[model samples]
Structures are given as C-alpha cells and as structure tokens.
Target: MARDDRAVGVSSFEGQATSAGQASLAGEATGTASASGPHFAAGPPAETGEPLRHPPHGEGDERAGEVSAGGRGRPSRAPPSLSWLLFSRLVFPGIFLASGLAGLLTLREIVAPPLDMPRILSGLERGGSARAEALTQVHEAILDPRYRDLKADPELAESLIRVLETELRQPITGSPEFTVAYRAQLCRLVRELDTPRTVPVLLIAVECRIADTPQLDSPIRRAAAEGVVTALERHGPDCVRSVPGGVAALCRAAKDPVAPVRAAAAAALGHIGGDEVCDLLREMLHDDTDVVRYNAAIALAYAGRGTGLDTLHEFLRSENVRNLADTGSTESVIGDRTCKLLCRALFALDRLCDRSTEERLAVLHPAMEDLCLSRAPEEVRTLAMRVDLKIERFHR
Candidate 1:
C-alpha cells in the first residue's frame, strides 16, 4: 500500500491514504519509471499483481514529461537563439533613431538662414530684388568670424553704400512695407560703415527727391534725409569724420529747409569745423526756426568763434533755467526748447574760447559759476558741472 504524495498521486489502495504512508512508500521504491526505477510519488498500485508504475518524466518525453505540482502535464517552449535576441533588441531602437535623424535634418533646412555669406552679400551688392530684406539676413553673416576680411575692408563698406544709394534713387514699385525695408537697410548700412565715403551719399540722400511724388508720399526723399542725419549722429571713426567734404556738405545741409536736417547739420558742423563753417553758423543764426538758430549759436560758440557769446551768455545766466526747477512747463515747446538751449549753451561754454573771445568769456564766468551752483534740470545740471570743471581747469 502507498499514500498520495504532492496531491498529484492519488492513493490506489485504501490502506495508502495517510501522509506517513506516502513518505514510507516513496522511500520503499527506488526505481519505478524504469522497469527497475523508483516510484517517488505517494500512491498505491492500481493492480494487485503487476509491478507498481509511474508516469515517465524525461526532458521531452510527451507521454509523461514535465508536470505541475498538482500532477497536470505542461508543454515545453524553446528559448530564442542569441542572434534573434540581438536582432529584436536593436531593430526597434534603430528604426526610432533613423526617424529622429531624418526629422532633425528636415527641420534644420527650415530654421537655418542661408550660410553662404559671400553669395548673399554679392547679390546685395548687385541690388537684387528686395535687397533690403536680404541684408537683414546677411547682417549676422557680416559679423560672423568667417567674414573677417569683408568687415575689415573699407572698400567693401563703400561698395555697399553705393549699392544702397542706387536702390534709394530707384522708384518704389513694391509694397510700402518693402519701401520701408529699403529705408531700414539704408540706415543700417550708414550706421555700420561710418566710413568717409558714406558721407557723400548721406549728403546726396538729404536732397534726394522723386520727380512726380508729392512731398508726403515721397519715400526716397524722406528716408534719404533721415539717413543722412542718422549717419552724422553716429560717433564713428575719424576716417569718416575727418573727410574734408563732409564739412562743406554739412554747412550746406545746415541751410536745409527741413529743421531736423538743419539741426543735425549744425551739430555736425560744430563737431567738425571748417574755415567756412563759422560763416554758415553765423548765417544759421538768422534762420526762422528757433531750434536751428539755437543749435547754430551753440556750434559757433563751441568752435571758439565767440559769435554766439551773447546768446550763450544769456542762456547761462537766464532765469529760464532757474524757472525750470519749479514748473512742469511754460509754453510746452518753448519750455522744452529752453531746456535744450541751456544744455547746449553749457556744452558750448565748456569749449576753450578763442583768443578773440577770451575777454567776453572771462567776464561771464562768474555769472555762469553762480548758475552752475543752483538747482536745474538733470541734463542742464550735468552739463553745467562739466562746464565748471573746464573753467577750473582753464584758470589753473
């Protein structure tokens, strides 16, 4: 008799239904699968005379292969080969990587600007369609380290200005936005290349007019004048500032009917003097626009002509500067102009007076010193302090 074992072998005899009997039966049989093999299960033989039998348990013998703890048979599944394992792991990741690379390559084309700087600039030099917009792209290229030679060359700068002028002189045929773009590029070119050659173009730009267009509708004429003034306003290299003709151009521009242009020209002339500029300044003093006359007086005084001494003198000691500290404004434009006059007056007085004007300047220094000691507008106060420093230095 034998007892059931692992709940997998049912007892075949009534006498083999106990746990102890099962252990005892398993211990008794050493060979059951073989004719002489062990019967490790805890169960009784079903037949009375035949030898006790058990199911065959071998690696792939389906008759009685691997079995569950509950005595149920199970199927064997083969493992994948090493080569197949490697292929499956890599193939999916490889597909994803290729997709990402393709996407990046496509995106780069959409995002990156044209990289061939020389080609872009060449087209700009030739004044291709809508060149102003092209320059906005090439601006970074011009500053790129690879384009050092172009940036260093004065001739290249001059050539760009020439092309810019040609474009400005042409008729506006496209969108007004395009016209604006052309104007913007022109300003950028002037500012970037403050070379002396640009001065002439700037001067020409000031008076540039389109034949049939009304004054308000005239893009070229308006942009040209603005561009000239902008160029003059820049603190650029002496190569541009020291060029001789700029003085004459500025002297003429000072007489321009446009007050802003005239004011810009006056300021430039004061900065860069000429034997003729003083007379121009003297003439500007009579102009109807107060701003032009005011700037001219300051320019002349700074140039050591002493011609504006009375104007500047009145400016330094005037009650207007004193009044500015208390009020928001008087007549707003007049009050604004008054502050500007004082600021320029102080700057002019800071300049060294010529031998011819020394006596006049010396007499006014005491009154100027008192005004410097008083409270005033920040710009005026700053300029006044600078003037005081110059006077202190002069007396020493």
Candidate 2:
C-alpha cells in the first residue's frame, strides 16, 4: 500500500525514437504462412507451378520467435524499399517540428493577457472557453506521446520528473503573454494525467514551476503560483514526496502576496507532511488571510498534527462556511476559491478521519458536522459522509 502511494510522472524528451525507418512497405500485407517482406510474393511458389509443399502435419513453426531460412519475422520486417529512414533521414523528428510550429502559432494567438477580475458575483460569470480550448491544444502539443509513454512506464517516472524540471528551468524567452501562457498550460496539464505513476512527475514539474514563479506581478507568474496550489489541491498527498526541495518551496510560497496562491500553498502542505511542513503550517495558522488559516487547519488535521483547532472552531461557527457554487466562470480566481472552499473543508474532514485518531475526531466532531451539513457538492458531501463512516468504524 505504501508502494502504491508514490505515483509516476511524465516526459517527452527521450520518448520513442524519432528515427523510425519509414520503409515504403510495398509488399503483400498477408496473414498467411508464406508472407515475406514488402517485396515478397504472397501465394506459395510464384515460380514453381507444382503443388504447395508442406512441413508435415503438427510440425508448424519449429522456431517460434526465431528467424527461419525464409526470414520469417526477421528481415521480412520490411523489404527495405521505401526510404528506411526518418522520412528520408533528412528531416529527423516530424513531431517536434509540428510541436514547434504549433507552439509558434499558439504564441501568435496569445497577444492579449487576461485582465484582473475583482471578487464579484457578476465577474465570476465571465468564462474562458476560448482560452481553455487553446490551452488544451497546447497541452497536447507539449505532452502528447510523451505523457502517454510515461504513464505506461513506472520505472522512468522519476527521471521524467528530473527532465521536466530541467526543461522548465531553461531560459524561457518569448512574448510576455506567450511565455506565461505556455508555462501555465504545461503546469495545468500536470493534473490531466490519470495514472498514479505520473504523480511524481506532475508534482516536481509543479514545484519547479512554483520555485520558478517570479516574485513580480505577471499573469504568467500568478498562473505558475496558482498551478502549484491547484495541483496540490487536486492530487493532495499523492503530489508529495520525491520532489527535492518541494517542501521548502511551498513553505516560502505559503507567504505569497496572492491570496489564492497563499491559500493553495497552505492547502497543499497538508497533503505532504514532515517536521518542516508541520512547522510552516503551524506558522500559517496565524496567517493574516482567513483562507490560509482555514486551509492550514484542514492540512494540520490531515497531517495528524494535534494543532490548536482555533481556526476551524471559529470557521465552523462562521455563517460563510457554506458553498458558493454560483460562480459561472472557470477563470475567475475568486470564483475558483469561493466554490472550492466548502469542498476543501469536506476533503479535509475525510482526510482527517482516514489518517487521524479518535481523540482528534472527538475535537473535530462539531466542525466536521457543520461541514457535513453544508450544501456542498455531491462529491464533497460524500467525503464528509465517509468521515462519519470512519468514525463509526473506529468506535466499532
């Protein structure tokens, strides 16, 4: 189970070899015993007009997987007629070429940057379907076979993370809009993967991006910062571990000036735990932002840290502890936060019940009940219910 916890990541650098010898396979594409290379004849004895010879009944395929005199599976791979090199070897990788072109076009379209939306109900309704479509295309171009290949191989997930970090850290030069847009798109794709094996790769990629997140106020930087928190929020503890300096980076980012980013950081730290992570979370308990403090309580409980439950206690009593699911925009940071708030609380209760003690749950019962009663989404309510089940199981 412990082994099952640490997940895989992604990479495209050392993906399938690009030098695929594209032989102009002109042979008979046969499914018979006499099929040969691209140039070979299909039927038996194209020259011999006699009856077909047999190797005796029950004597088929004497050399399974091995090449026979007829060059069965070996040389018959291709007649070697149609340019057995990477589209004539002159043009190495077509995918990378395509990616480069697509990337350029994407940059061309990224002329304008997104404007800031104040935390208003109306603003939250403004959406980004166009940007989302553009981002999806970019993710495919950047990830594609690389992401697919990495998901299939657990052995290479660690190295994939390393390569991604190295790649993201390289000198990023482009139009301000393009640079941020590209990085943000890549960062967002980190969670698009389904396999647990890709977790490490996604985790490190996000951390390195956050570490690379510039201190200045740019949309790209904000995106990077938000991406880190988003990933942690999405994957939780699965995103923890294996990242070299991830804890330190999150600890630092927890103090980010951006409220959403700071809340995200606090939320993420709970998924991963250590003496250092605990210390940072404890400190965040006193953070000026109510969002940060609220997230810190959940994280601390998830980490099984017996912290002073002051924030959670107060939060449970606050009237604003309910869901704000009315946000219609996917891009509004305020909407994102508002909607996720109750969900985050529900998620925390579930984690705490799964990983904490009966003693902790006793103190948590009131707040947990309040969260469970809140009109959260279906999944969030389910999470809250699961905690109740866990508590009952513990008592039994």
Candidate 3:
C-alpha cells in the first residue's frame, strides 16, 4: 500500500464527488476541478508510476499553507510599499554614503597631522615644489602668534641654519627660476629669525656663486646680506664676535662684486667699532656705486670715525641733494634715494659734530647750510635744519 505524503480530504461539488487528492494545487478544486470531471494530484500525472510527493517542511510550500488558511487559491506576493521601496533604493544608500564620507574625514585627520619644524625641514630637504611649499608654511607659521617665537627655538634655529648651509654648499638642480626663488625664500626666513647663530650661514650666502650661470649676482646672496645686518643690529657686537672669521666674512662681502651685497655688508659693519672696520668703510667709500658709498659713509660714522664726515658733507651738497629732486618728484626711486641719502648724511653729520673739533664742523657746516638753501624735499630740508641748529649750538 502506498502512503499519502499530503493530507487527503473529500468534498461534494454540485452532486459530484471531488477528491482533494485529485487536484494538483491547494485550491485547484474550487472551480476548475468542479467544471472538469477529475484532476491529477499535485505531484505528477496519474499515468506515471512514480508516487505523489509533497515538498518538505520549511520549503516554498509554506505560502501554500497560508493561502489555504485564508480559504483562497495561492496569491502573488504583495508589492513592496512605495515608502519602503524608496528607502531601500535611495534613502538607505544616501545615508550609507554620508557615513562613509564622515569616516574617511576622521581617518584623514588621524593619518595626516599638523605641520611642525621637523616635518617642514624634511620637505625642504627634498627640494623642488616641496621646498617651496614648506617655505610657504613657514611664512604662515611666522604670522601665527603661537609660533611667532620660532627663532627662540634653538633646535629649530640650528636646523634652519643647516638647511641654508647645505643649499649654499651644493649647486642646486631643477628649474633655475624655481631654485632661485626657493633659495631666496629660505634665506629670507633665516634672516627673519634674527638669531645671532645664523651669522655664519648668512656669510656663506653673501659669497655664494653658481657655476655656469650668467650674472653670478644671486638674489639669495642679497637677502642673506640683509639678514646679516638684522642679526648684527639685534644682537649687537657680541653676535659677530661669536662666529669664527666673522669680521673676515664681512670684509669678503664688502669686496663682493655685487653692489647691494657690499652695501649691506658695509651697513652690518657699522654695529662694531674697530680701526679695521673703519678702514673697510674707507675703502668702500671709493666704490663706484653711490648706494655703497653712502652705506660706507654711514657705517664709518657708526664706528665714530670722522673720516666719513667729508663724504657725508659731499652727500649733502646742493647739486647731489637737489639733482634727483629737480628731475623727478620724491615719489620716484631716484628722488627717494637722494632724499634718504641726504637725511642719513645730516643725521650722521650731527653725530660726528658732537664734541668734534672745529676742523670737522667747519667742513660739515657749509654743506648743511647749502642743503637747507637748496631745492631739496621737505624732509631733507627739515633734517638739514635740525643739523644746522645743532651745529649753531656749538658756535654759541
């Protein structure tokens, strides 16, 4: 005897006996089985020798049981609600994408950190755009209040000094324009630090010479010379004394072919007093460049030597003082240069005249009087008047 795997039930339909076993589906007996005489069972056709089979528990037949409980034929699954479909397709994915972005942002903060001296130095060592970028960060940090005292950091100052020294020792590779600019920026930052320890590296910059490049006058050297002046001014004579061969370095820069370098070197020498420094200023007074001569004269005055008084008197003479003023307004560089030269000369003259012999004042008084009478700029005349009054006090 064959055992039935499915439940068997019998029902009467319109005076005919219909067996549920004769139907191929759960509710197939409701209409089609009643109209047609009898239907085969759900498993297979009656002609086959195979026994009828039912799906095992927990299979797709569970839906069939649910339909049977509702007293209806098997129904199609209900379509997803509009809101559920929208959430699954669009809203959920959007939320997931936002979460992913936030995670990445947090990770980035953890992986890459803020800038510091060691990192900046590493970038500088690599050269090229990285070096330029590192300098830019240094500039920004300089403006930041928290980092304004970077010069006070001994380790950082030493690191920067080494960087400047290395760049000078090795001929830089890469685009000329880029390399020049990078070196210029690096030199400028070192200068801004105004630390006395940087004097040696700055001296190297003043003497830097690139092989095979036209016009050996490097902007880096000019910036370095300016830095030397700043450092000397801030730290005084002790700053130059601390470095080996410091005075000799200034002498080398004073003899540099570049006029600006000589001018800066001459200005830097003014901070210290010595017969040797006075002699250097006297030699620089013969320089063909007017600015160099002017700086040398001022430096000699700073060294308290009256040797520059004659040079100062010449700077205040009517023709030299009024030449630029007549040709162009004080707004022009030439006019401004003349005006500044005159003012500095007057100031230096007043210093030299203090407790000075009549011979020195006698030579300087005529130049001051002429400058006051000349068609010089207001500021120049104003300073000349002050010097004239100071000289008058000596006569009184």
Number of the top candidate by lDDT?
Answer: 3
Residue-level lDDT tens digits of model 1 in 253-336: 666656766776776677655667788888888788766777787888767777876666655555665576446263677678
How many angstroms is residue 19 displaced in model 1 relative to the true structure, after the best TM-score fit?
Answer: 59
Over 4 Å off in model 2, which ranges? 1-175, 194-240, 317-320, 323-336, 354-374, 388-396
Per-residue lDDT of 205 in model 3: 80
lDDT of 3 by residue, 1-396 (tens): 123322232223422443434453533654333445455434344556676677787776687778777989756678999999999999999999999999998776556435677878787778667876777887777655555556676776776787788877777576767677767778888887846888888877877787455344367778888898788768888788778888888888888877888888898887776888888899888889878888898888766677776666666554656585454367767677667666666666666667365456666677667667766777777777887888788777
Error of 3 at 365 (Å): 3.9
Q: For residues 100-201, could you state the per-residue lDDT of candidate 2 as single tens digits?
A: 999987775654333222321122133245444443443554355433543333333333344345546666555545655555555455444444544444
Candidate 1 local Cα displacement, residue 41, angstroms: 74
Clashing pairs in 3: none
Window of ten residues with lowest summed lDDT in model 2: 15-24
Candidate 3, RMSD to the unseen true structure: 19.9
- TM-scores of the models, in the order given: 0.50, 0.47, 0.59
* Backbone clash total, candidate 1: 6
For the record, the alpha-carbon RMSD of candidate 2 to the native fold, in angstroms, is 31.8
RMSD of each: 16.7, 31.8, 19.9
